[model samples]
Target: MTLPFPSLEDLVNVISSTVDYIVNIVYNTIRGALIDFYNWLMASIEWLLNYIRANLPFVISVVLTWTALYKSVTAENIPLTRRIMNILTAPLFSMFALSLVDALLPREIKLPRYSYPALAIASVYAETEARAEYIIRHRTGYVVEAEAETEARAIYSLGS
Candidate 1:
């Protein structure tokens, strides 16, 4: 007599087909997301490259300005003369380099004439403020203590 239930072979085939369908769906979904991500990444890179190429002079100017700001601000523990020189020369050199780059590269955008100088001035102001705050916080207490000790010694000597 024939069995009422499906045969083992038929059951195995159904399960195998179900697993294959699920795997294909998952694989296609992951593959599509990866392709989209790759396309987006490539497009971003291409846009960045084109922007840099088109605005090479402005880019150079910005880089030079930031370099000058960094050099001037980081010159903290140096001698007065050296610090002055650093503060002065960094911006000058940056401006000169920017000018050179502007001349050398074909520009689609022009950097403002006053931008570097303004940024330099702002950096100097920031450095000065930092130094002032440091002195106020770190040196004021020592100065007050030294003066008090000197006065106390003088008073003792006079009493003796």
Candidate 2:
């Protein structure tokens, strides 16, 4: 039996296409993963906000205020130069903080009779258990969701 050999131009075209396929895969993988992660984060935040609004307004306010304070502190810990720059941009930071409090705190929680600080404290107890997930979880964070999404896409393409 005679074996058929691949022609020179045919071999080159095959190699080029193969490389293109690999590149496309890698790019699509990363892009898909990021999209997935972003979608996941947005969905989670929306769920949290809606949930807090409907079933846990008071608790949501407290948790949100805590989240604001925590984020501000973290932002404050930047290197001296960046810290100075951020301080210079103080209004920007304050705006961001206020926005968090505004967005996360349900209006019902703002009734005239309510005590903001007290509610936050009460929320602290309620949200304390999940604190570590955001405060203490490993560095992967939302990035991992993106990565996993990409990996799944690549695997599916290969398997199919």
Candidate 3:
């Protein structure tokens, strides 16, 4: 008499085939996802490069303007007339500075255009931080002085 159920070998074969199928499915899914991600990353980089290339001149202009304005506003040693003159002729000064730098740098070694905007942004951040610190210091000093004055008044009142 033979058993009606499948043989052990047949059951093992079926299980192995199912596992292989599932593994292949998973592998294909992951590979497709990775390819999509890679494509998106490359597209984003290309767009960024194109945008920077297109806007480089505008970026340089903004950097030069910001630098000139910041320097003119912050120059304590200069007379008011000189500061006004500097502000009025900021464009010429900026051009001269750029020309000087271009003349000084080695022709073989070119600097990236992005560095100009980055440096300008850094300078603005630094100035903002300094101004914030100054305000905070003065505010705390005023608070301390007020507290001391209040304490002195309380002491005088008690003595009287």
Candidate 4:
């Protein structure tokens, strides 16, 4: 019988050379990709920083909220009871708004988990409008503004 054999040292050298070539190619590719990605990220960050710094109003808006718009009392004719009801319901409306936000916001994005304040100044007018609607629908003397004004003058004999 005839048998063929390969030298162990020659086999090892061939495998070693092939592995070294593969490792070099992979290392260079990964290193180049990493450097490019890092440079792109740094440039993007610098651009964004400069943009925000140049736009003072944009920067301020990022820090400010819409709460200032709803803090004033705009209704002069609504009954005190309705006004008080609006005030009391502001927190409930804010809760609904936060719930809506949670429901609508995409889950994959970080929502920056925050506790809703007991009430937001931003929802105050919305609460007032809802209360006004309820009052006008279920209660007398709280009808549409024009009708209420006519009725009020009829009773008080002011503009009759």
Candidate 5:
């Protein structure tokens, strides 16, 4: 005789269909989220690549200008007037340099592959500043050179 509930076969079929419906819903949700994330990441990279391609010439000009300004200002053989011009106009180049460094540089002290030119420019600026300070304070280049030599010797010395 049949019990109060439906037949066992019908009961089994209903349970199976419910489980399949739940699994499909969950799977579709997860897949849609992953697909959307992948699409967003690809779009962002594509936009960046396009932006760099369009602005490459301007970026190169800025880098070259900053490099020339730095080298000219640091060179001792260059005439004082030209050096001064280079130094004064340095801030213009520096605006670009500063922006690039701030936007591109990581927050760590370690240098990345793109930081070589920035490092060189910074080194030149530091050297120029130090020499200027020494000249202003001592009124002589010889004294500064001598002091640098002494500092180097002290640093390299092994004695007590």
Candidate 6:
């Protein structure tokens, strides 16, 4: 029997090619799994969005009413008269607050509306006009800052 002798360069090339093939397979498998996971997450999000869209009014009503009820219930620490007022007017106030949110704020982003009741409460409880305006602007995502110079135009205008 004649013994087969492989050259060093041939052995090295064979080993290198095998390693490269295994690495490529591993990489492709991992990449494919990641892509599939991403697609599944995106589909789930789209499904949720479609569900919300299908029940827009109901969702809005529930959100507003829930926020108002939560706020009223949490006002136990406040003055009794004010707490009573908030409880009585939470429904109407919630509607107005949510309307402002829908009309003024950007639709792409759903801002936290739980703060609406607190802002409404503060606007009623505030002692100064400046404080009330500040609350209003803050709640509406419109904040005014002190300017350094007259020529210094507002860095960001509204809706920018």
Best by TM-score: 5
Give residue 74's lDDT in candidate 5 (0 to 100).
Answer: 76
Q: How big is the positional error of residue 142 in model 3, measured in Å on the Cα after superposition?
A: 71
Which model, 3 or 6, shows the larger TM-score?
A: 3
Candidate-wise lDDT, in order: 0.54, 0.49, 0.55, 0.46, 0.53, 0.54
Clashes of 4: 0
**Candidate 4 C-alpha error for residue 149, in Å:** 84
User: In model 3, which runs have C-alpha deviations exceeding 4 angstroms?
Assistant: 69-160
Per-residue lDDT for 96-137 in model 2, tens only?
Answer: 655666567565422111111111111243655422111111
Residue-by-residue lDDT tens digits, candidate 5, 1-160: 8689899899999999999999998997776566556656665665676666556545665776778787997798999998888867866776676566556644323111110010111223545553312111111221221234434333322111
RMSD of each: 29.0, 23.2, 25.8, 30.7, 26.5, 22.1
For every model shown, what is its TM-score relative to the native structure?
Answer: 0.38, 0.31, 0.43, 0.34, 0.44, 0.38
Reference-based TM-score, model 6 = 0.38
The deviation in Å at residue 148 for candidate 3 is 86
Q: Candidate 2: which stretches are off by over 4 Å?
A: 1-4, 55-160
Ranking by lDDT: 3, 1, 6, 5, 2, 4
Poorest stretch of ten by lDDT in candidate 1:
112-121
RMSD in angstroms, candidate 6? 22.1
The residue pairs in collision within model 6 are none
**Model 4: clashing residue pairs?**
none
